[model samples]
Target: MSDIHKHIEESQVTLSELMLPSHANFGGKIHGGYILSLMDQIAFACSSKHSKYYCVTASVDTVNFLNPIEVGELVTLKASINYVGKTSMIVGIRVEAENIHTGVKKHCNSSYFTMVAKDDNGNGMEVPGLILDSKIEIRRFLKSASRLASKKHSKFQETNFEVEKYISELKNHNVIVDYKGYK
Candidate 1:
């Protein structure tokens, strides 16, 4: 709602850390939760920088882990504001893992997090608009807007869903209907 606008680069954040054995899972690969925690931290930093206020995570969109990170690999996470509403921003994060020996990097995960700026009293505060300058920035903003619309539509469908109408369809799947009252 603020008249002030800022560029995407103004608030971008990147974090890199070497993956340790303690951060690995029993399978020897880095734990997904640890990476997620890192992503959240970067998202928070990026959004807070942009808004100039304390920000809290509202939601996180699809997180797809494409590659497994190994112990001793260097993991890098990049976060930027892709879109902004009156008081909320969608932060896009990209995670990559690099081999220390070969210097080869692979895309590990991509996620979108919705963050809301908050005031000292814990109420939502208005955030500055984005000044998208490049085609890529505009594309990212449009995609985030589309994704938000799709999420709203999905929620609407869920709210209006009728279990009785779809109950019989469950039989076609792997689930078993054991209740006697639904006959």
Candidate 2:
């Protein structure tokens, strides 16, 4: 197969939806889960458009809810491929809510979703290389790379971490450790 390269803007996806009363929670605010579902949809669309294959969400690196979306606001989700590996792409999503009456906009959430391209047989498939055109694109790619590295290092620490040493460190927080249990 020939190598494929794509620009970051080539596969960008944007979705806008009006929040309805049915989508609101008991507090009359739009549900965060609803917004997350929308983000996942846009991420899938962006990655699939870029990779030309079905994509699955491997992991969600970060999801920061900056502001609460209210009912009757227009919510927009923008997604683009921030970074690409052989078979994986990091889809960065930004969500915003606008008050239709006053035309005020609020940043709702930001998230990064790691997606893996898959063939019809459910095997991993190669994805197109990202062509970063601007400084912002390059910065996003580098940020995603660093986030991925941090995640791996954190996993390694979690796997081989020493509980005995950790217990001592817990003294910095408000916690009482009763070491009576047998090892």
Task: Give per-residue CA lDDT, model 2, range 96-172, as digits (tens).
Answer: 99999999999989999999999999999989898888999999999999988887787338669667655666679
Candidate 1: misplaced stretches above 4 Å?
155-158, 165-172, 177-183
TM-score list, all predictions: 0.91, 0.92
Best by TM-score: 2
Instruction: Predict model 2's lDDT versus the native.
Output: 0.91
Q: Per-residue lDDT tens digits of candidate 1, residues 82-137?
A: 99999999999999999999999999999999999999999999999999999999
Task: Give the C-alpha miss distance for residue 9 in model 1, angstroms.
Answer: 0.5
Name the lDDT of candidate 1: 0.95
What RMSD value applies to candidate 1?
1.9
lDDT (CA) per prediction: 0.95, 0.91
Model 2: which ten-residue window has the lowest total lDDT?
161-170
